[model samples]
Target: MRPKPVKPKGGQESVWDYPRPPKLEEVTKTIEVYFNGVLLVRSARTYRVLETSHPPVYYIPQDDVAMEYLVPSDRTTYCEWKGRGRYFSVQVGDRMEQDAAWYYSDPIGRFGPIKNYLAFYAHKMDKCLVDGEVVTPQPGNFYGGWITKDVVGPFKGVEGSFGW
Candidate 1:
């Protein structure tokens, strides 16, 4: 069963208000990803994908990321809207996180802007920040959304949210 959507407060956005077909919008906020005490990426130019019942998933342009730390993995997954996604293993020093990032080399439909852009799994990283605010990873390991103070949700990927 779907949980009741939370009413957003001032300066907040309700995930319920997002669309079924996710929207990709350019974000000017500073997006940062860190792993093993190392900065993996930091950028003001990024895109965020917002969908109903989900927190925003921020994608950083390849140019802004530390590509050397991301080694391509053999795994792949499909998103109905975004097409096939290729995974990457993140390694910083001797520490490594497998399949910790993903990107679509050739996205479908309106998602072309995200091609070659990568989205990291916040839970696997030391920290992910948006505009300097630390983010909480979206519930469950399958989704890569990042939860922040400005977004409200009884979000998908939580227990009992599989059918949502």
Candidate 2:
């Protein structure tokens, strides 16, 4: 017989809690993302930009992205804390990068706030902009931190990185 299913402790969430974005605000960051010398993603879709211990990630909505450049990707990643994260690819001029963008469709109620937004790997793109100023991606291959003119970071994915 199957073991009795463990239930979530009262008031405590299971490991399926995707980190929810902060409260929505009237954010007006002029954001841009590029790849293969092409501007693949550009928008002013920054709702709540935050610089966490990880990186400065701008949570953006579906309306903000030019979906013409996006297509469904077959890749998926699961974090014990974030549930399953789905992936997408930015298609532009015949160059395609797989699983470069990700989102959580079914996060625990605690992180239910960000059910529809997405984030991209800033490094995979050739360029990015915030507020009309070109934003430099943080130094790493796997992190999406937008290090612009003012923000700084002790960002992850940069420590002890070797040339890939």
Candidate 3:
């Protein structure tokens, strides 16, 4: 059963209104990510993938990220819309978050714009900020969507939403 979507308030967008195939949009907002007391990345040149029943997944350019802290992991996952994704474990000092980030080196179709851009799991980070507002991580371990005040949802990745 599909859950009812939350009604969007002023200046807000409902995830249900997002596209099925997903849309990749360039974002100019200041996106910042912090992990293990380290500023992982902060950039205005970022992209967000918007899909139905999910909060936007922000992708930061490789140039802006602290690549030294990200070690490639053997794990990989395939997305029907985005193609194959490779994982990265974040290691800062002795603290490591395994499979905490992912990216597509060669994206399929419309997702090519995000090639080599990294998307971090908000739940794995100390905090992720969009336009200065700290975001909440989307529910469940499998999806990495970032929920902010401006986005409303009965988001996917909840316990009963596997079929959404």
Candidate 2 per-residue lDDT over residues 1-164, each given as its tens digit: 11222244554322112123422344566767777777655566555434233436665677777777888898987755446888889888788887777878986545566576777887677667777767666665665666654543334456553321
> All candidates' TM-scores?
0.98, 0.68, 0.98
lDDT for model 2 comes to 0.61
The residue-level lDDT of candidate 1 at 49 comes to 98
**Model 3 per-residue lDDT tens digits across residues 1-164:** 77888999889999999999999999999999999899999999999999999999999999999999999999999999999999999999999999999999889999999998999999999999999999999999789999999999899988889888
lDDT of 1 by residue, 1-164 (tens): 77899999999999999999999999999999999999999999999999999999999999999999999899999999999999999999999999999999989999999998999999999999999999999999889999999999999999999899
Clash number for each model: 0, 2, 0
- Candidate 1: where is the Cα deviation over 4 Å? none
lDDT of 1 at 111: 98
lDDT of each: 0.95, 0.61, 0.95
Give the range where candidate 2 is weakest over 10 consecutive residues by summed lDDT. Answer: 13-22
Flag the better candidate by TM-score, 1 or 2.
1
> Which is better, 2 or 3, measured by TM-score?
3
lDDT of 2 at 131: 70
State how far residue 94 of model 1 sits from its true place (Å). 0.7
